[model samples]
Target: MIDKVIEIEPLDDLDFGKVTAELRSKRREQDTIVLFHPSDSCQENLHHFIAGAKKIHGSMFDYGVNWDDLIWDIRGFESTTSLKDLTHASNVLFTQDNGKGPKIKVSRKDEVPFAEPFATFAKAFVTHRHNEKPKSHSNHMVAIKALRLLYQELPNSLTPCVSQLLPEHFNKAISCAMGTQAKPTLYVTGVHLTAIAESLDEYRLTATPMTWKNPIPRNYKHGGASQNRGGKEAKKERAKQLPKTDLLLFLAALWGTYEEIEERDKALVCMSIILLLCGFRMDEFIGLDLNCIPSREEYDKLPLEIDPETGTLARILRIRVLAKKKGHWDEKIVPHCTVDTIYIAVERLKALSKPQRLTAQIMLEEGKWNRFLEFDDDDYLTSREVKEHLGFPGASATNTISTLALHGIQRDPSSLKRKTRFRVGDIHDGFCDRYRERISPIINGFGHDELIIPIWEFLTLRYLNQYTPKERLNVFAEPL
Candidate 1:
């Protein structure tokens, strides 16, 4: 009722003092007034005034202020806001909406449909997960999409107060998905369904035990490959199919075919090389900040002393990145040679601009960095831009990889050894395999004697020694 009655104050007539006083009076009378300001500065001032009011009112005053609504109002302002501000405000609104919980918009007549109670349960489930177990924005979106799909799939004849969701209904959904959808997609859908059932059971939304199992089988074929092949085997298969020569040819074509490749294409080439060598996820590569690379001070501190035994550079460059899978910040150190190559590539890309940093100004000059203007330099490259550059028509990472592989095949017919297609994951696997084959022997030899290994190799060998065995045995499986 308060949400329905509250009116947005005009930006020109906004008075913080008057609004705060009215809010306090309303609180004393056990009434609510949700105030909305169209200006960010005014909203900040109101927030401060409200804080001060709370201090004076001894914390008993109950005033409800919707931060999301205020942000929406600021965004809806017609003439004053810039496009960048509007985009940022829209993102903020979306994030806030997700935090509130899942919302289902149904008409009055269809409000109590067969899956109506499930919708209610879903809202509660999302709210609880949002508060207790936070997830990434992408994951949240997937959950919401899965719920919507489930709702649409349920039969209309079922009542709102249904006692159970039959297995046949789930089977029907799976059957409908077969041949039309990838196994991974169906698997993820099954996972979301299981999560929903478990949450409902946890919250006592269902009287019967809603112990739903994931219906998607692990060995289900997805594009001629089993989903259960695991990362190592899949990587090995991809590497066998995708010879290093193919990637090399693609790079050659990218750089040498044209007398003067566009600066953006050059940047793309550099990006691809770094991604392949560093085994970076697309998100990790794009998320890199200008400052994330070693600063001059940090570079000077790098161990460059030559090893007496190996007669090689004694240090490697450690580039710190926030890995998405780890859910915490971690560092990825590259060999000195790899670091040098990346530095050169980055410098060349940066040289295209006057700012000498990878900003929208530089990346967008060639119309390559799509949507880069909407974000700050600290954020990762937009998914849209990455997808566009990678030749992926769709938004999914899988699509990007698939398209990249297809493009590689189309561009260099002579380079590919097998008809089997390559994937983004294959790049990572190839890098790791090559590192093991080429660098692992040197490392093993160093271990045989009291050789002074370079710091990078030393660290790398230590990690491999400790983890590689278990990794092979699936002790720490990579997330699919």
Candidate 2:
């Protein structure tokens, strides 16, 4: 059964000024919570408001004012009071018995001329931003940081609002950021600003004020020419320092050393090999449940499928990995293992999976899981423990360096003089290079049309651009 149809106007179509007026009218009529969508954009707007308030009033702006608190405060404010009184009440809530507490008074003369417009704009902006598609966490963070910087540049006496923004303000803010951050970072910040402008434009709040020419060039080398040059030289040096033969010898030495150490150390080395071979990110494997490992039956079935043309065993083992970007599970087909390293590693982990060991593993994984895994894992493992296990980036680089030293290979001084350390990522790069070398001859012998399945699977797994061979080669050659 259907009742009378109630058609709600789309927020984008509604006039921003009219909507704010309606909201003000509603506040005057009733003191009740108004429902608003808790989208990322709305959340960001609330965050910006609180940050602006803090900058203006410091400790006077209550730290406990969340979304509901702000909503309720706005709704309950005395309609006849000046905007200054509303601002003061919103910033500082008094809970003492109404008349018994310190008598609070606000004068209309003390009010900033733009306070009312600011409040109206804030409400309208957030409402317009509501129910929007969510942006990535990294994108949201950049937006918040940009907003915070913009707020800091504003005079403390005035309330912050989107309408206050100007092209000059953005230019100045971006210029300040450029002093400390790289061009790529500035470009990313510019992207955040553009996103904000787009949001504002959708709401018809203000014509996007971000018309300033972006200082960072579109084709600008990410780390500058010198750094890029140094990176290529370092990559070559690493490749020369520890070629395939040296890498195998290093692994053998590591295995021999692990035999003398604890079971945990042995498990770590095995995991490291799996990570290198399978191209698994540290975060992907770190929190993996023991159940993720294939059973003996499953392992037995792995090599059953064979390619009709080449008579080569086809990939059958598939593992579910968590996609960090979308927060969903994606199936990653296990690549052809050149050796029995990953299998041995899986078995070692299974053998080491006692209740205490599982608990420790969970703790380590949870502690190490971060936005970029850039933070120190010292809380989970000590420097010596990390070195012994070859877990951290620094440890991996040190292992390679030390292994090269043992082989009487003279390490290039330039390789060790970089800001970023060599990591398991370097090993992944080398793996891709080797994989390409191995596959190129096969592709040359048999046309790509004949080996389409293997080629497609390989390209998909590696996240390579399917249509562009140059892009694929670049990705394969580039050090992650």
Best by TM-score: 1
TM-score of each: 0.45, 0.44
- Write the residue-wise lDDT of candidate 1 on 1-480 in tens digits: 456677887888898667544533442221223222212243243333343333433222112223222111222222212211212221111111121223544333433222444443344344345434445444555665556555545555343322344445555655655645566777777777677665533333333335567767664443433644667977788778663887788786775543387643655676776776677776455445444567656786876766444568676566655465664456786665666676765555444322322222222232222223344433332333446543444445554434334423122233334222333333333333433333322222221123222212111111122223222211110101
Q: Model 2, range 156-241, lDDT digits (tens) per residue?
A: 43555665566676677777677756667777776665655554433323323233445565433454444544467767866775
Model 2 vs truth, CA RMSD: 22.9
* Candidates' C-alpha lDDT: 0.43, 0.43
Alpha-carbon deviation at 471 in model 2, angstroms: 48
Structure candidate 1, residue pairs in collision: none
The TM-score obtained by model 2 is: 0.44
Model 2 segments more than 4 A misplaced: 1-65, 68-138, 155-157, 207-215, 218-248, 306-311, 357-480
Worst 10 residues of 2 by lDDT: 454-463
Model 2: how far residue 185 lies from native, Å: 1.7
